[model samples]
Target: MRKDKITSDELARLCGVSQGTIDRALNNRPGISPKTKQKVLQMAKDHGFIKNQYASSLSRGTSNLIGVVMLNLKNEFFSQLLTSIESTARSFGYTTAIMLSDNLEQVERQCVETLVGMNAAGILLCSVIPDPAYGKQLLQYSTSLVSLGNHICGEIPHIGIDDCAAMFDSTRYVLRHSYDHIYYVSPVLSRSSKENIDAQTQRFKGFEKAMALQPSVHYTVLRDPDTYQSILKSIPANGGRSAVICSSDSYTIQCLQLFKNSDVGIMGFDNPTMLRRLYPQLSTISYPIDAIGQLAVKTVLSPVKEQKSHYLAHTLISGTTIK
Candidate 1:
């Protein structure tokens, strides 16, 4: 027998015990003596036998893998969220397989198929898919799903921020500050070759509702493919104190780049840690993204998932950008 990659049976033979005894020791299951387990573990480690629990789970028709699907990694908020989810999942002894949908419905559908085929225990999706019927179809596979940023399906619980409420409050904060003009910046609609998106769509709706509170206030919804370019032309040349509120911090940061110190009040949603630290003066709606990750892991892995959804509180930060 090779010294490397010792099988469980081989380890059992070397330890002079039954294969079941070795199995119990490696898996830390009951019915094995501490001394025996310690010896088996030490021996296995000495021989470089790292048990493949993932493969074993597949054999047992179960899984300890969490599937996480989202849009691209370029978005600061999504990147931060992914890290939180990964770290939280690991604490619960579950590994994760992450896939990016690139904001395409077909790509998201394929990602779901692949994760399901891999026997994933749960899928945490920041969904891009447009149809709820597809969500029902996934349920047919008896998969446990939880949504983070988007509402891929209403059935899936939301463990993230309430985009509508947060954005509404943020917009109101801007209005209260008395900016003469407000430019609402968002990616526009959730559309795929097929679909916030789960939250992104709601965010715009929230902004609209908030704007209605002051119908007379001059506001422009800059939601084009080239939204930043529009911003340059949209702001009044007469210099009436204007403000630009983006749906996410990524967009807010982009504005800072385009119009550095130009005196346009810039506000954004989702105060991501890195960005916030780098641009502390950026006004934003701060959501506990880290907590969202922890809750998502617990909700998905729980045997009884009684809670259908969650709405964590968001704090509005009145930073220098508002002035």
Candidate 2:
């Protein structure tokens, strides 16, 4: 027999035991004598036997693999989230199979289908599409789905930060600095597909709410592909105090570079380590990304019931950029 392709039946025959006994011994299932189990394990180890978890799961009609689907892994937040989820799932005796969607709806759908084909016990998805119909399709395959970052408008359990509250608090922090002009800077969604608009809309609503509370203050919203250039032109030439509250850390870092020599207060969201290391003075609302990962795993493993959404809290980390 080939050492690499050693099977349970082969091991059982060599050990003078039934295949059922070998299965029970290898999986640590009940109904096996300890002495026989030890002997079988040693013999299998000596013969270079390696159990196939996927095949075993297929035979049992269930899987211990948790599927994780997300957008591109270039961002620090997504990378950290993947690591946290993998680590947390392992503690629960589950393994993770991660797939990147590259922020494409079709890619996301394909990844979900592949995971379902693998019989993933549960899926933790950072969906590129937040449509109810798409969400329904996902539920048709498996009800054990936990959405991260963005929530679908359906009965899908969601684990993410309250974008409205996080942006509101970040806006208030910028207001406290007494800047005369406060601007909410976000990416222009005009080119984005319909399915990818929910998250941006939610954050914009929070910014609008905070701006409404201070009607007397001069505030504006700049939706631009080149936020730094637009913000630079918007600032008064005669040295008026201006501050920018960006919807993401990447935009905030760009704004920081734009106003490096000026006294402009800047606040961003998602306090990533790279931003902190490069610009220690940058202020941001730090979302509980690690907690989101842990909560997602717990939600996936729990018994399927009514869909529920979980909102983790965000912290406003004060830094020199916010003055």
Candidate 3:
């Protein structure tokens, strides 16, 4: 018989219990006898009686929904990564609930809380929590939870690239090209007890280290949007040979569009499909987005105690944009 087709009356008959008792046992209500609970659960296991999650949750007043919080769904890279995760979740017969927080720490935390309130079976967090105390508090919940891209550090399992290593490798690649004036553009960097890792800081360290070895190259870091636009305005005037690197593909792509003229070399992190197709000359680092999604679903469903931490490395996608 199809599991979803099974009803409470059928389960009660199978377990030799009253419908009321089965309801109490499944819902974890105090009135159900321990002996009866064990017998019902065992029978359910043997006969696949537990397969009807929707009906079961309806009787129990909640569900096994997997909640996902993505910080920047508008970013094409993140959107692709999230879609992969959602697809994996669906394959496992899990319903997904997604919340977008626009990369705000406050909104991210709220999204998590909202998911929990919905009785999530597990939560896949893809945002940085601004408050460490709340992250610690989140551990108290019995729900299975994991983080992606950004993580909650020790409290949660994460599936993502070693941001530090990816940035480092990308920077090293840029430096190897012998761009005399290498620059990095990033969204403003912020420090929080909740966010232990800084992707930009690690990337900057790589840039600095590389430049130190090559004393001849002049290096600069620009975070200002106005300065970025100003720099782009003068790219053609300065000559086409100089290179500019961006921490994000979106930023680099936007800057390139601003200049209109493809005189200067531009490289970005994250090998977005559109970027590669639109500007064949744009060099990038391919962060394994699909793999990250695949691993996240595997890790979240795996027993937390047996979960292993994985760090993916990035690959350089060289293009004619840079020498």
Candidate 4:
């Protein structure tokens, strides 16, 4: 009799009807007989089947589907992340349609529209999606969306690490090792009121705040791709200026490649298998990719049974790359 645990499926079974039929009847769509509709209503009330007004409206038209938009899927980190999300969505009996783009704004926008047109129950978004106006469009959808990444914003619920604090902790850890000239390499920041886009700004603020505490330490930022080699070539190998904190595993891997056996201490943001395998001693921040994926699925399917969204937490993993 608890309102929390009652489900649409259970209500449909109690009413001696298929889930689709119950859905149609409950959503007040045409097709089912008046008697069947009445039966479904009485049963739903008896079992305390709370209808998600949004899903009910959306369900009148299409199949249950979840759209996933991801960037850099070919990367090991994203590939692992996608696998975990896909597995979780499957467990909830949802058919997930995925769109992959190499961080192109145009392609990402197209993918979002395509998925929306498909009548997906909800969408799971990650990575650099262009067009700020599109974020407002998402809120209008009846589908429940959950963003998975450090960079996501808005009233829409998201699951990811606290980038500012995570990076601050990582940087403080590096400072504790007594390494000087700690540089943070990250993508250039963008201006937006949206919560997701604000992540980069938060991270930079964390770095600035942390740096202020230790006035003597030096830091610099490098976003230039063409002259990155020249920047790497300028660092001192044997001095106290021997450490660098990168924004991501992808950036760290690039740093490692550019400075092979160059004795420059390196660290990356996300802890990936390759980060550990290639540089077992590399210190980096780590969070559970599988758990993030699982949470995203749980959020999408929650409205199906009229469950509320839940917040998840992230923990940092320590390794040897710092000192």
lDDT of each candidate versus the true structure: 0.82, 0.81, 0.71, 0.70
Tens-digit per-residue lDDT, 71-186, candidate 3: 66667887888788889988876788889877677787788888877777788877665555766787887777787765565766767776766767777777787666776776
My TM-score estimates for the predictions, one after another, are 0.92, 0.89, 0.77, 0.73
Higher-lDDT candidate of 1 and 3: 1
Query: Lowest-scoring 10 consecutive residues by lDDT in candidate 1?
Result: 187-196
Q: Which model, 1 or 2, shows the larger TM-score?
A: 1
lDDT tens digits by residue: candidate 1, 120-209: 888898876767687788667767899877765666677877889999999999999998989887654524224635577788889999
Q: Which ten residues in a row have the lowest lDDT in candidate 2?
A: 188-197
Ranking by TM-score: 1, 2, 3, 4
Best by TM-score: 1
Model 4 scores a TM of 0.73
lDDT of 3 at 171: 72
- The 10-residue segment with the lowest total lDDT in model 3: 188-197
Q: What's model 1's overall lDDT?
A: 0.82
Which tens-of-lDDT digit does each residue in 1-323 have in candidate 2?
A: 64664788889999999989998888788999999999999999888999888898889766889999988787788988898899999998788999999878889989988888888889998876845688777777753788887776558888888898888888877887778888777764543455556666778888888888888779877776756466555575636788888887767767877778777778888887667788776688887878888999999899755587888888888988888
All candidates in order of lDDT, best leading: 1, 2, 3, 4
- Stretches off by above 4 angstroms in model 2 are 1-5, 16-21, 28-38, 191-193, 226-230, 233-238, 304-306
List ranges where model 4 is wrong by over 4 Å: 1-60, 127-132, 150-153, 188-197, 304-313
Best by lDDT: 1
